[model samples]
Target: MLDTTGANPFALSYNKLMDVALLLRKYLPHMVSFGMFARVTDITPKTVEELKNLHHLKLDSINIGIETAHDPTLERMSKGYYAFDILEQLSKLDEAGIRYNVFYLNGLGGKGNGVASAIATADVFNQLHPCIINIVSLTIFPESQLYQEVINGTYVEEPEIERLMEMRTLIDRLNIRVNLLGHHVSNTVPITGALPDDKAAILREFDKAITKFPEKELKAYRSRIWHL
Candidate 1:
């Protein structure tokens, strides 16, 4: 039931289940776990309600990519929607009784604005209170504007240690109880736990690294090709 259309709302092929769901229904066991990808942020709440039928088929999870909380960053990334739009769509999903995970990116704004981007993203996650929060560090792809800027000497990459410090600050400030998943390769250090328990310990690890690790080593630790 994963909607593998990336983040495009209009990319949805139909209002209801397509042939894939039918095929899965035909061969898969009734109680088997299933998940789907959908850009809940870009579509109207009505479109999300259509997914209510998924419960009839026994869907276990859904994942949405809520890249950043800053509207300008989203527009620059071409995510096709604003932060509030995503919040509205997530609320609708909750009302429909569908469980979902949200993905957020750190260091997306690069050096100058990276810290603010992390803070804004944390605010959104606290508000949504999703089942899981997947945090990933920003990576420039060869085909993306970020990549071009890097090649042309216009983009200065953020050090891995600074990024980790920003993330540590974010983790320290989160008030909700959702699980934090930092398993992505872009992340310099990956740890998972319920907030306010291991949360302080996790942030402490990064804080120590910030003070102990040298600039070059930190940069090397943070550089990676994976997105999430």
Candidate 2:
């Protein structure tokens, strides 16, 4: 989220990396796997290649928060990249044979814009091709910029059901071969399944979730269900 341009100026030198690599090899002879949460903007092909060279710490996967593909939503959340920059960097990771997971924040777009945000995000996912896509609903804690926005009446938090609809929209719009895991502490409903293979099933599950609330009380339920 810090990097909008996908560039890292402060990378560890290859010799310094080799020093750490030697220590890992000497201490853990049997260690064969490693993973990391990385900023998609900072991961270049060279970074992937460097990780691949380290035999003891086999970097196989990375986790990144793509937030939302909609630029305004990203701007709203302080996530620094746009859809094109994200796609380009993820493409680099793919070309370097690095598998990765993406995290999407539901309700980040605020109120009624969830559907638009989900559609835009799904459009990018189709091209970016993450191994897994995870979801988390927004929770505005105190002292953050988002919280400040809420204080100033600049942002209206979406209701829980609306957030679920946003998640469903993202699930419905995806046309890629990726695992969709919508389990998070903040999520109202847990939506977990594989894409393409479980698309229809997930849709059914979403429909059930939507219909669970009686249509008559859904509007009022917003104030009753989850605290903003």
Candidate 3:
């Protein structure tokens, strides 16, 4: 898979998957492992078994978008799966010995729901246990449904610092042993480390971020640099 596909390759038919695997075996003889972007809702027991077979052919580190674990937020964000569905699918992935990284978008639940979003997300992470968790705040795209929602006053975005606070709450609530990565275009302060081991240190880093960047300035900075 040498393509940037928005589609879940696993959602394709068995024959299609076999064609892909055969193509890779023919062309990339030395590459033992590869990765792809997949949605959390697309996994089933059959998909997990196919993924396990793909793992035998050296497919690794699939990136899944959990985005938010709050059911309302997931629905508003247009994610096809709810928290329980995500947990169930990830559990299947674990049973299949397939490794994956999960991406969580901050500010998905907006201002009043930040803490709730964080707590729910942390709850899912505690159960699912992915290899890595990538955190980044939401950014608006003019053509997307989110931008329309924001413009029409349906989605109220939280302040950038409020999003950071939610991120802090997530860090604090994390009870697992996975790596966390927050160095992205949307992260105000880049935080990289593992949980339960560097928990205190990560909290200190978040405190420093809080002190270094005030809410007002962060709001302006993020808006100024906003892109599609």
Candidate number that wins on TM-score, 1 or 2: 1
Worst 10-residue lDDT window, candidate 1: 1-10
On residues 18-130, what C-alpha lDDT tens digit does candidate 3 reach at each position? Answer: 67777887888876676677777557535667767877776665788889899988887677789999899888778778788999999988878888999999998898769
Task: For residues 1-228, write the lDDT of model 1, one tens digit per residue.
Answer: 342334343235544444555666877655465666777543463554465665456554668877777776787668788878877878766766777888777877667666777777777767765888888878766778788887888767766766787788678768888888987777767778877678878877787877887888756654545443
Whole-model lDDT for model 2 versus the true structure? Answer: 0.73
Clashing residue pairs in candidate 2 (N, C-alpha, C atoms within 3 angstroms) = none
**lDDT on C-alpha atoms for all candidate structures:** 0.70, 0.73, 0.81
TM accuracy, model 3: 0.90
Among these predictions, the greatest TM-score belongs to 3
TM-score, structure 2 vs. true: 0.80
Q: How many backbone clashes does candidate 3 have?
A: 0
User: What is the Å distance of residue 17 in model 3 from its true position?
Assistant: 1.7
Q: Write the per-residue lDDT of candidate 2 for residues 46-98, one digit (tens) a residue.
A: 45566556423454566887788988888776777788888888886676665
* RMSD after CA superposition, every candidate: 3.3, 5.6, 2.3
Ranking by TM-score: 3, 1, 2
Q: How close to the true structure is residue 133 of candidate 2, measured as C-alpha lDDT?
A: 91
Regions of model 2 farther than 4 Å from truth: 1-22, 44-57, 214-228
Error of 2 at 38 (Å): 1.2
